[model samples]
Target: MAVQSAPEKALETVGPPSAVEEGEDARVRKKKGTLQDRQDMWRIGREQELNRNFRFLSVLGFTAVLMCTWEAVMFGSQYGLLDGGAAGMIYTYIGAIVGFSAVILSMAEMASMAPTSGGQYHWVSEFAPPSCQKFLSYITGWVCVLGWHTGIAGCSYTVANMLIGILAINYPDSYVPQGWHGTLFVMAVASVAFIFNTFLAQKLPLIEGIILIVHCFGFFAILIPLWVLAPTSPPSKVFGSIEDRGGWGNNGLACLVGLVAPIYALIGPDSAVHMAEEIKDASRVLPLGMVWTLILNGTTGFVMLITYAFCLGDIDKLLEIETGFPFIQVFLNATNSVGAATGMTVIIMILQFCAAISNVATTSRQLYAFARDNGLPFSSFLAHVNPRYTVPLNALCTSLVIVCLLSLINIGSAVAFNAIMSLGVAALLSSYIISTCCLRLKRWRGEPLPPARWSLGRWSAAVETFAILFLLVVYVFSFFPLTRRVDAETMNWSVVIFSGVVLFALSYYFLYARKVYSGPVTRVKQLM
Candidate 1:
């Protein structure tokens, strides 16, 4: 159960260096002077053994549900993920839940075999043939990072928006914003979460557990009130046929357009696998967490949406809010008391914070893991560990900084921030698609799958193939602006996904990947 130290100890003990070799040896070893003496390397083994009491399984499920708990129940039901401004996204969410649900089933199996810090990138490296490993893993890392960052930034601003909504409901004329006000609030909230994560990644599982309890229990907080205020709707209206939106011409296609909105809610469910090195018994805990997390989220989110729709009966009225946050309007009407609506707003804000916290853990650890493997730009420095905390302190701090900078974008344009957040979902879903396709390809090639605690067995290939198609379909839709409106403003999400790739490639070929960075490094390199 003990992990071995870094592999550089061999070079350290060499006799006072007088003999020096030049060429190839110098490229891998950085120290100035003396011949690059022969260094011993350790074969890969299960070394980053984390503490293991089934912690991840207990926490991860709740993390996923807490994120969408508010969104699905309050918003999706009214708009049906419609794609109209924020209101229409109700339909988009339904599609995402269905799509991601398929993808996670596939990923849960993959997680058992290659549970590590690298996640999609590492899994691709191990399962892929040597020739394609480098390129595929690199692409996956970029996509994954984009997705994680989007999820984090989305959570931060979503939290801010929720807080602002709370302010509006509580105080008259609290519209306060030169745009910078919301930005400042977003940054402050994000900073607080960032600081907490940097200081407390180790305790995240426990914090997530507490959040989970509130996340699930908080549904009743609203459900109880809405049920009392408005009991029932015509069954036909609630679940019968798709209500008309626009341009769709048919309800069937409108459903397709709706998929783009909720894609993010279904993301980060498997994020626990990114922290495979941190979870104890990750092979077991992580997989269970990934699967059950979806189950918990899917069930609650579905029930919550149905209940809200049954109670809400009026889509037109819900969409009539002056601020365009229909969920707030729902509270204002449902309670008829601004004070009670303010209380519900507080609950929603708590949920947003919980989402941010979950992402901080998953995202920072994944970045740390990728860097540990020499896949990121300052990998050597980023892969460092704080011996006292036994945490990837450097990498965590770097991730915090990156997200903090991303928060500023909110100041200039919430639309831009929302668009980037959308693009991130595309990139993320793309990574999942690629990862699942890898699984399908391996089966076709008759490659032997690694043994793991959780797997889909006979259904594995089919499940993965289904997931790939699901994500591909949803990702394709991401390019279209909802409301049939295309500008720099809305659903520009796909643009950033493309931009993130172009940006990463530019740097990879010219800067880091070529000059200082290389391939598949380990903590072993740092030991030197």
Candidate 2:
């Protein structure tokens, strides 16, 4: 039950790191390095099993593509356009960038301190009150895992439907869209992600490096066409209009609801934090990768949003388009050529597919980390790293199966599948709220924190406080349906699904995990 505070004792005395070493001396040694010391301080049992193939640029690429903000803006613009219009989307997006900046900075500080693949849960384990650490950490792990799985589902859904959209665009009259079609594509996307994360895990850095080039260039490719070819809206409409088509009855509330798209686009900046062990100079590179990805993606996403606003053509017609996506309509309007629009649409699809691939990797790593600490069923199997590939093959397989099953929900009801996917937003924000709140409580009590290579220095208090307050507001609105009048079809059932996940996790804990699970903190109790 005791927690360890010193690193040297843990390294020297806690056996041989863990079962997941490259060789005898490649990872663990008598002489402690800074990375090892930090890992020891956090009681992370797993050695450096995954290759440290990711440098700053690759990490940045991974985070950027995972978020894929500009592409998300286009994919999700329908909600914003109907509820909040051009002015609303733009202003809310700018606010999101500002609000999430605080979040990114606070998380960067925590990543510097712990730098573990467990991310928010691991930080909660270390920073929460010692008497309550185990329960809180266990709950956070479940929430974090739920958030990640939902994220993969959401990204895969986007990628699959966009592929369908392309078909609809080309065969407008003959191709009848079916829910089963989307489900099949979703499964296909998940299968591809599994293959890449398993067999091609070592080549991720190089792959992401290439995608990063495409991520940047694709922005200009889409942007220049909109600027040159699309018909422009007046300044008043682009900057002053507020369309309240959602029947929210209040423009402000409608705009707030519309913020979901932009916020969802920015949700995964902590992505790099979950891949910390695979990143070289994790304490330093993790923070840099996270913060810079936010800044870089935010700038480009903002410009894209504004450009889309100007070139949006007709919101009402686009919303009812056959393809079921508004951005395709926008591109078609801009170029007046199906071939040109398909080319641009394909760019977004490719980036989103890439996001799905990285999302699978990140989610699997988190699952592996949680399992390593006995937080889930079959912990030992799920936590096993293939000694040859250095990848958690079992965890990756589990995640793939989960994704395929979740996709089945779409076949039954697209609305229900959407509700399930929405769980990611609420679940992730809950983890962020808990972790940042725990960090602030420690700081307020003047408790000593783990050494941070990327400290916020004098501004840490303000940043953490703002992050909590802002995330709480977003969390509440995230569960609000786009309309005031809700039916089973229109309901935002994410809150309901999230509660179900919470209930299941708590029941599992009390029934089984309470006895078996010790939380990650106890692993370092000997060093204290």
Candidate 3:
């Protein structure tokens, strides 16, 4: 994005002068802090926030829409199912049920209430006990930053690697870059995702729309091959019985590690809700988007999952296929159609391009919301919105830069890159848990923050409770070290990720966060 227009007189230095007064008052109020507590609750449709400018239904639908097929491709392939380590378990019915329960219960309400880009931190500041507000919210923001950015990095890497796999499978002799190929490809892909969003931010929905159509159309296109050519295979032979694969016991922890497959695949469905303010009837539409995405992607993904399982004649052969994607082999087996498989592969690539484009918007909105209130360190730069485009140029660029640096990590340490992505899960899960815990606490105490036009009603409390417990379990499991000895070929990336999250959180506490970093530039809402 072009540099934002020069703010007239440094944008009036953002926060109102009264912030100083409020800061002083906050200190005095805390001195007399009681369990009764006090909250700086602001009205929902305040001057600082532009209530709802965009069409809510469109934006909400768009957010959750594409997630339907995105993960189907991921989980339907070997990477998420076979190699994503944690996701393998997640693709299973039991694991998906657990994840579904968590998302519906916990994240749904939090997204409705806090709806800000800073996500966890913005939420923490408004809700946490007055005394611990600074530390808790700040940590939540930092951790969430890790989760959001690392999630982007992970997708970039995953897509890059998949593209490379396409090349290695099709053109074995082609001169692909060595050792650092992934890093280079990651850079290139990030550039594409960034350019589409930055220069063309306004047209994003159109592009997103096109992507959605293609995703749906492509699913149909590929189904023809599975039905026509692969009809001979049946569930009895192809999909292994629980007894055949040693069910859950023999797989042991390896199965648990596979949870990442579904987790990664189902990720970003909530992206639509993040753009709540941009949509027309956001309250009505956001939840609808979630349901739409869930149904669409859920149905397609399950079909692919079960079909692929049924079609596979040999699990070992599927695993040993030289090309990283074993599903191509499934197509080859079912239809004896490399040509069709190749076609499907191309379709997926196109859809992935679409997914990447959507991701840029996702990251931008997040950065914009965060910087709007000066949540990040470089508030002055990141908070600037391009007057012409009405987009947050600095935040967009910052996101791009983060992804580029993350890509470089693939060259220096592949394990580090993987670990970062793993930690991302923990980061996101933490945000979900904290937000729901806050909601429950708030409800229990009868505190009135702004209510959403759309709400879950009495079930809100129960949903949040279930979500909190589920996320806690998921968080603990995310940190559980992968068993590298089970497969020495791949490094145990979990330890590095778990440790990195700790360092980032602790470092924030040690450095700038101690004194500065007032939770979400509430004083400067107009600037955002």
Candidate 4:
């Protein structure tokens, strides 16, 4: 018998369960088994051992906390201001909100259709042409896996830097942050995330729910105080002023480089896609969760950017503050009390820690899925799900180890580590481009898609086209150096690092993987 394709298998599974034939064995088994037993055996067998504990609200909370838009702007706005000034910050944020909204909508539609933990790669295999499907899917899986691994390192590194920033506030005269210090802090933060992902795995949804409340309410906690205490700038200065501190000569080039900041902030909403298997009614819930995350973060992030622009005072002095982040300087200048600034910094730190934990969860799930599909070396070991916890224990451990190794880069060269962190945007956007482009091609060719619970219907073509084009443009800019004169220290290493990852993945595929890996296995019955 010929094997069914993934799309066909998806349709078969979604259809009504195959009826049990009536006979002695069937009747006795039907009588003994519950109603669920009468359902398609293939469908039941396909479900990997993961707990589908996430409801719509819980998933929304998870995605919102992962995005953490307001917090990101607070810490990452320096790059925007350095390149774009106040006007660039405002307009770039608006553009990013629109652009990323399109990107996520396209991804959400794919999630609705496939609803698998493999996310982009799985979609690529389903939609890509048969001849290139395996190769494309394999490379996409590696890119996503490495993108998320770097993302974990980036989040933990930021948290570590912030913690050191707080210490600087307390001891301005004596505090000096060393590379080793940041590395140690990264390890510390990663350890906390490991504990949560392994020991407290079941509490993730509830924890994310609580963090969502903080994500919303915490906006007021920081914003209200800043607005009340900080001296405000004029409308022109807040909305029209442009700065080119990076010596890029052309203001337009500066603005393009600055776009990376907001793009980075908007990149991880797709983190929820990796959790599809662990989400209840994932076809509908995943799309709803992703779109709502964008709306909530986009609105809050825009307001926070505006607030930052207006409250910014004495640019030179703020930039000169001993703390690594300019936002800490903003707090100090506004409050004029080290104690108050440190307190507010602590709140942001808590939220950052929560976001790091969520990153770990997402990274592990993606790794688990890819390994389950035999897309990674040591697939059996990495894909093992813990019976007791119903979590990917081995995969989580593997991610933790890789994160620890990546954090070591901070010790030798913070600049190089930063370049690695910057890979998140370029790497992820490439994956988005491939998957969305595949989707658009399939739609354009009128290939019949499996029915999707959450779909764009009439608007799907336009949205996918826009999303693919937008990502292609952004993917190019994500590699531009921040300053005109690039040196070892100032270079934007995203392109180099991203290129190296792709090269390694392709090299591995040609050397060993192509023979063993055949894209996603069609035997759903063997998944468990």
Best by lDDT: 2
- Mark the regions of model 2 whose C-alpha exceeds 4 Å error after superposition: 4-46, 411-421, 525-528
Query: Any runs in candidate 3 off by more than 4 Å, and if so which?
Result: 1-57, 65-91, 173-177, 231-233, 237-240, 243-249, 411-421, 480-489, 521-528
Residue-wise C-alpha lDDT for candidate 4, range 1-528, written one tens digit per residue: 125555447645454444544664843442323223222123322443676678788898888887778888878777788888878888888888888888999999988777778889988887887778888889899999989988888888888888888998898788777888888999999989989998889889899998898888889989998999988889987778878888988887788888888987787888998887777667788889999889888899888889988988766666556566889989888899999989888888888889899999999999998897778889899999998887889999999899899888644344654576568877788789999998999899998775677888899999998888788877888887777788878888777767887898888888888876766535433222
Sort order, lDDT high to low: 2, 4, 1, 3
Q: Model 3, 294: alpha-carbon shift in Å?
A: 2.1
**lDDT, candidate 2, 391-477, per-residue tens:** 899999999999888887745343654475568888898899989999999999998787787899999999999999999999988
Q: What does the lDDT come to for candidate 3?
A: 0.57
Q: Weakest 10 consecutive residues, lDDT, candidate 2?
A: 29-38
Using TM-score as the measure, the top candidate is 2
Please, what is the whole-model Cα lDDT of each candidate in the order they appear? 0.62, 0.84, 0.57, 0.80
Question: Per-residue lDDT of 1-528 in model 1, one digit per residue for the tens?
Answer: 112234534543443334444463642332221121111111123233233322664557445643564553453333343433232344455666676777887787777666666778766765666566666767788778777876777777767766666666666575553566566676676677776666665566677777777777887887788878854677665555464454556665666666654655556677777766655555666778887878777777666666666665466666555443567777777788888877876787777777777777677777876776666777778777676555667766776677667666644453654465566667777778777777788888997666666888787777777778788887876655555555556445557556866587657846666453333422222212
Per-model TM-score, in order, reads 0.83, 0.93, 0.80, 0.91
Please give the lDDT score at residue 118 for candidate 2.
Answer: 90
Q: Measured by TM-score, how close is model 1 to the native structure?
A: 0.83
